[model samples]
Target: MGILKHYSGGLTREQFLFYEIRLVASLICENNSRDEIYNRIMQENLFQYPTERMIRSMTNICFKRIDSLASQMLMEHLANASTAVAKQINLYAIMRENGIVYDFMTDVIGEKMRTQQMDFSHKDINSFFDTLQEYYPAAADWSESTRAKLRQVLTRFLVECEYLDNVRSQALKPVFLFPELEEGIRQLSDETALCAFNCFC
Candidate 1:
């Protein structure tokens, strides 16, 4: 596991593809400076609802994850694919990049799935958060409101990505990466692709 970074509180708390953010990130060129990208995105009105500050955070989150070929393909699917499932994968990537807390949560979920257990409870999540706090002091200081929101995000993540039937239910749904996409992921980074497969599917 990687060293957990302090949780930044800007992650959107709903299922969002951020199509506008994707449009903005697609404009990034190899030589574009930070100011250049920001100016261009503003001029184009790529994101308007969340205020400029939130837009910038969202943009940074999506932009950083697009370096690898697998990530690039995932972005393409997220941006252009019509299916909800494809967009779900895209959202997963967004959460993976932006939600530092989710990495730990997903690891626990993956382990449970391996044992043919598909149910989860608040105590299960809280226990993971407790363990997470050992490595991330910030987790220990979260307010009740923040902790509640994080729990909501976790359930929403599973539901939106088709991993769970619903937020209130625990039965896990089967998810499989398409062969072509899986091949692209492997070609780009075998280790990452394997981890993705185990964690999600």
Candidate 2:
């Protein structure tokens, strides 16, 4: 995944969609192709989103994120692991799929963890975007509303992964990667990205 020239806004619609992702992962483990999975979801209304358009949009994001791993072991873990482990695994998958998110986790959140800076605030997010716009000029074109929504989505993602105590507190929490999940991640041969979880190489 090269540096993404344009940040995807899909997360704003659904952040760390654990249940939806688990459903998709389960289907993937069953040897379903992308089209088959999408069709199955469409037929079953598995996501229970109440609108076909919403379901399609979410499935697109989930597939993009899951396919990025390309690891059957990880997909199995995502489908069967305990909720906490599954969330972490999904977060890792998101980082793999989305360069903007990966950069934020590593450069902002991970760096904060390394430096023992427990307090995270909107200011930090703004600063990160400022730096991001410098390198990825397309990011500079995002509307304030879009930027705000992205910030909300990113914050919720960290909270869901237990990296933050809550949105209000914005306090960093210690995240322990399950051994099984860690092994699954290592299998991808991208141990460097483990730093995003505060696991220094």
Candidate 3:
């Protein structure tokens, strides 16, 4: 079952918006310590996020993502890249590394792709969640409303990352890795490379 007993991310769609990607990229480019970067984001009055907690969450997530990729050189490559898509892909990788839900979500996508199931549907998402609940009893307690929202937000994230054609539409779109991105991935440890490849693929 792909269900999480105690899902850890709990991030809203708003927290994963395009601007946040830009914000993360900027932070990575600055290459400051986590506390220094957090202070810079908070004091510079740049993002205008909802609360201090959300800002902290974003900062933590970004740092965790950088760590998961397991290479400061790759982080530098990503920070220097020209396309927003590269940064989004990196963020998506981080999300996969840091969030149980994201790992399951992408695994489902990869499975469907391998099976040549090109079009995804809401029913598939429901089934995936249903399967999760079977293994994670706690998942059974999640409200239908909450499940629906998560499904919507996850789909939106895929669309933003060019993994899907659109929300509510399961058309899988492959993102071609930039040359620098590819090089960086190759430089990572075998385990980290495999994990990053799963997200990139």
> Which clashing pairs does model 3 show?
3-132, 120-170
Model 2 has an lDDT value of 0.83
Per-residue lDDT of model 2, residues 1-201, tens digit only: 233323565556768889999999998888999889888898988888888888889998898878887788888999998998889889888888877788898889888878888888999999998999877787888899988999998999988988877887668987776886778768777775677787875
Show where candidate 1 strays beyond 4 Å.
Answer: 1-17, 25-41, 67-71, 95-102, 188-201
- TM-score for all models, in order of appearance: 0.70, 0.91, 0.74
Task: Name the lDDT value of residue 43 in candidate 3.
Answer: 86
What would you estimate as the lDDT of candidate 1? 0.58
lDDT for model 3: 0.60
Candidate 2 error regions (>4 Å): 1-6
Residue 150 lDDT in candidate 2: 90
Error of 3 at 102 (Å): 4.2
Model 3 residue 52 lDDT? Answer: 85
Candidate 2, residue 172: the lDDT equals 90
lDDT of 1 by residue, 14-103 (tens): 335456545644565345676777777767766664578766776665565444233656656655565564545554455355545345
Question: What C-alpha lDDT, on a 0 to 100 scale, does residue 59 get in candidate 2?
Answer: 94
lDDT against the true structure, per candidate, is 0.58, 0.83, 0.60
TM-score of candidate 2 to 2 decimals: 0.91
lDDT of 3 at 71: 62
Task: Pick the lDDT winner.
Answer: 2
